[model samples]
Target: MIESLESHPPQPRPIRWWVRACFGLTSPVGQRLYFYTGVGLMAVKYIVEAGFIRLMTGRTLTLLDFVNPLLSSRMQLLQGAPDWAGWALILWSLPFLWIAASMSIRRSADAGLSPWPGMLVLLPIINLPVMLLLAALPHREVERPYGETLGADDVSAAGSALWGIAGGVATGAVAFAMSVLLLESYGAVLFLSTPFFVGAVSAYAYNRPASRDAGSTLAVVMLSVLLSASALLLFALEGFICLLMAMPLAALMAPLGGLIGKAIADQCRGRRSHAMYAVAALPLLAALEFFVVHPHVREVQTSVEIDASPQIVWQNVIAFPDLPEPTEWYFRAGVAAPIGAHIEGHGVGAVRHCRFTTGDFVEPITVWDEPRRLAFDVTEQPEPMFELTPYHEIHPPHLHGTMRSLRGEFRLIELPGGRTRLEGSTWYLLAMWPQEYWIPFSDGIVHRIHQRVLEHVRDVSERSNGPPSRH
Candidate 1:
């Protein structure tokens, strides 16, 4: 009966003046202005709030720390709040943004366009023009209003919903089972590969009428499961992998999710095609992730003046201690530090293993270069006492394997005065979680850590010129 309703002609409604006005100004230029203005205002608000938080904390704030409190507390409160509250909160809270977006999708019956076009909003910049175009289109009257009276056609809606839910649940269960089975052995590879499956499923769901509802639900579930597993892996591994895993997942899932969403909208609303639009949107979203979301990994250099001869400072810096004092910060922090190896057998692959034991954690040396640089690649970590806490699990493979790439270098220059200028640079990548959700947080953390590490090196290097001191 529901399928047969498709033959009924849509009645026309008089377009409201305000709606017409909105549509008239919906040109590319006006859309761009509206979007840019909205984005700019959001940026300013975040910046000001960040500054205020930094002042209060007496330390630089990262995006994660800023949202952590809200995610923990006010998230539930937001659901019952008004529409303005939903919009404002979403502007501020990353997690809520997804929900707010889902709600923004009105039924196709309310708008003249097929429901599939609603998926366009998921595309980045391209969605702006599409939305304006949609607003400009005329509305259609409902042939048979929903919930006014029961009709045979209503059965299809119920069937569609049921099929969607069942499909989503079944797929999610299978993925979860696969993940669990693979957890002990090929966990890393399986976790890394999840994004591809998610994308494929999402694509399949949107493209097929029977699968639409199920696909969206399954995507959400899969996303949650993958995220949890990935986070666990990050804690276990703790370095490059955290960031690496996110890239493939985002590349696949984002565009595919958008496509599926558009497909569902089209089927419900009777739209023809959105193929060209989806093609254009994929790269734009990827670009946004690369430039706007990814954190900058920079090598910083600074010179610290020390009232010691260059030879003496160089000797101390280059000394390959068999059992170095635990005072080295990285050593004490339980991160692997280089101890007894050189960069190469003669030039590049030397291995130094320095160990640090801080109260909270221990670091072991992963890479060691004498006289110039040292690197720590964290492979193992202490177990967490709590299950739900972020730090409780072992860093994932992505984070652990990649973290070992961090390197710090020191250069000594002789001065006319009986002093040495110690120049140093530290290089490390910022491995962030939930890439899109925590972009601002990742940027803030990287910036603050970079500043702090440089400052510490300067203070320590300069103080070394005096009598031996504790750090």
Candidate 2:
């Protein structure tokens, strides 16, 4: 009997209610359960998020801030927050959002309604009323058969994959057109929402032909993004470096999209999925983000010690000779490197011209406290970098003014003996959303720029005269 039982397939383990509620694809959630559970979970999520934000920022978030659907106010809060806060909040709340979405979809099925309306839970402002409406709706006793044939077997796996890729690429192209070509935005909508929908739409389409396992869906979504990236490169729409820089953020979001896609595919089976139409919202969101949100100023400071006095270092701080051709791979890879600097006149009101491989920065001297501090306002700056692209060159919109240096200052602090501590700070604005993700790159690049200039100053000052008299 034991041998026979072993030979026979064992009974499938019963899924717990909580597990089904949280992650089940085919479970139908009744109205009373869905309403109370959703409300309670949402409340818990809000309280937890607010508490975390309070702890991280030392500032309390009001209920108004929590319920508001507008991105502007939320982004402003994040702007003031520590670099890790936004990312932490996102990581924290993703599960809540996922649970809410799943419950909504399942609740719709219980109410004998299209699961498409349930997807509104992912949208803002509208989601509140959607939940209320879903809660009020009475459950209908409809017995839907599981795993009913949807003609998926008719289409081959390779064909399904190809269709998914095409759909994903199309979605990305539309986003690129709206955000880059039309509105000239490099904000969160383009960076965050686009990748999400790309993964979602692609996964939905791929699974529409035949629903695959989670791992397969992830693979398909990743492949889709890779193809979309290739499309950008081959079409000369974006360069290698820009795309490479974007990859990390894109990678972070795309898998979540894939998971959502897979969820929709698994849950909304036998019903036509509304994922394609959902992608249409990308342009509208982009428009909203572009109009309401603007880039904020950020500062980066880098310091180095030199075996020279403040007076000797001050001379090089004002203007320096040509730097040798950059040996850094990033500089060689199209990031502009400082070549030389020249000053037209003496003291304050003098125009200091700093030359980079790409072009010049026209800086007007504001303070010229000899041997101590040097400050200037950048009136004009050239292209941040030349994009590494095929063909002659492609002038992507971001290269022009996305990153701007507003002002800069160099401080020379005298230390024991004859050595000096040189600190360089640049105040700039980066027109990118999710500042936490991009700030590090910007800060590092700026630091590199500072290092090149400061190091050159050190070499020159140490090798030359001890101290110079103020003009």
Candidate 3:
């Protein structure tokens, strides 16, 4: 029923170029640059990020950061931007976003689907499957309401294979150069730009009916990722660990990128000539996104329940003895593990020092509601982790200052069973892009820290005949 409703004939004018560049409707679409068109234009986006964008950020971006799973965040929300540059960078993203949206719109229209489906191209996570499904859909007989219809495409399997090769080469060079040279050490380069570039370019290059199949799109993207990965490895630009981490990302992102590229490519022709110059622009855009849009720090919270009274727990909460040796392998590796804490002073202005393997967190007490709540602000802190790197001395920017424990607290919620729901929260900032990769580690580290404290508190409280923490 839905298909029957949207499956209308091509009963409209061609979508215009500049208009098509901005919007996906009305202008008469000429030269459906489907595969080639998408690739070339996509490259333009990267070029903007790599070139004009780098001048904004004060950090030296490097390819090493791209492959490192634990790269530090370059978000400037804290330090702020160079007034004009920050806002200007944001404004610049408009065309890049619009072009991407327009490409998807045209692709959807070419597939004889509604324009609304095109917006799915802009989505994250689910965008891949959505694109692949759209690519698999058969092209309908229509006036191509979004763009001008072209004649039979000469794109063959062999041509597509070549396209994949070409796109891979282009993707690797631009992605590396953008990250290393432009200093766009943001996560988007590795997580968004690289896979997307290869996937989209390969799918478009295929430029054949088979390109519409999910299998074909998936295969092309996989091939492109492999080729690109191989090249990076050969150049020593990427390490084995980085490649392993990048696998799932490539699996999802590449296919999604290819399908979106294919859909857009299906609408226009003629990028065949200009694709070279457009692709040439990717490094620039990669740099721009890095400088203009620095990754922002975010916080995560975890809680647990202890079978001890708040009065009993508050003692250990304020300060405790040393923690037992960690049995967890992660703790033994490189992640920071908590030991114990002790406080100096008696009231709201008291100081607390919680020690970890790497360093001590210097905290100052703020609110002290005995047996009920205890809070403090992190005034000084230590490095997040000791390098698990297989080197004599390992120091990465992320380990030193990227992550910070801004503040912390311990809350004791009274339950009817003479027990307390102990919730320990560490207000910390993760200054890293693609938090998806590093967050789990951060969360675990905090939890382990909390667990050590909470459990110790429980032990001490239950063992002693101490007075209840009076409200």
Estimated TM-score for each candidate: 0.39, 0.81, 0.55
Candidate 1 stretches with Cα past 4 Å from truth are 1-103, 107-109, 113-133, 143-297, 300-309, 322-423, 427-466, 469-471
Error of 3 at 261 (Å): 5.8
lDDT of 1 by residue, 1-471 (tens): 223323443344355632332222111112222233334444665676556444433445455544442222222222222224323433454322232123223323244433334444444334445545543443456553211222122234444444433433343334334433322122211322233233433443333443335445445435544554454444443333333434544444443444344334333333343333333333334333333332334343455666666655654553323334435443343333332322223323433332222112222344444444444442333221112233544433232322222455556667776666667554544333232233333333333433443344434445566653222
Task: Count clashing pairs, candidate 2.
Answer: 0
TM-score of 2: 0.81
**lDDT, candidate 3, residue 219?**
76
TM-score of candidate 3 against the unseen true structure: 0.55
Candidate 2: 10-residue stretch with minimal lDDT? 144-153
Best by lDDT: 2
Task: Give the per-residue Cα lDDT of candidate 2 at 74.
Answer: 44
Write model 2 residue lDDT over 209-313, tens digit each, in one string: 677877878888888888889888898889999999999767877887777676666555667557756677778767876777666676778898888889889
Model 3: ten consecutive residues of lowest lDDT: 72-81
Model 3, residue 306: distance off in Å is: 4.0
Best by TM-score: 2
lDDT of 2: 0.77
- Candidate RMSDs in Å, in order, are 13.8, 8.3, 13.4
- lDDT-based ranking, best first? 2, 3, 1
lDDT of every predicted structure (CA atoms): 0.38, 0.77, 0.59
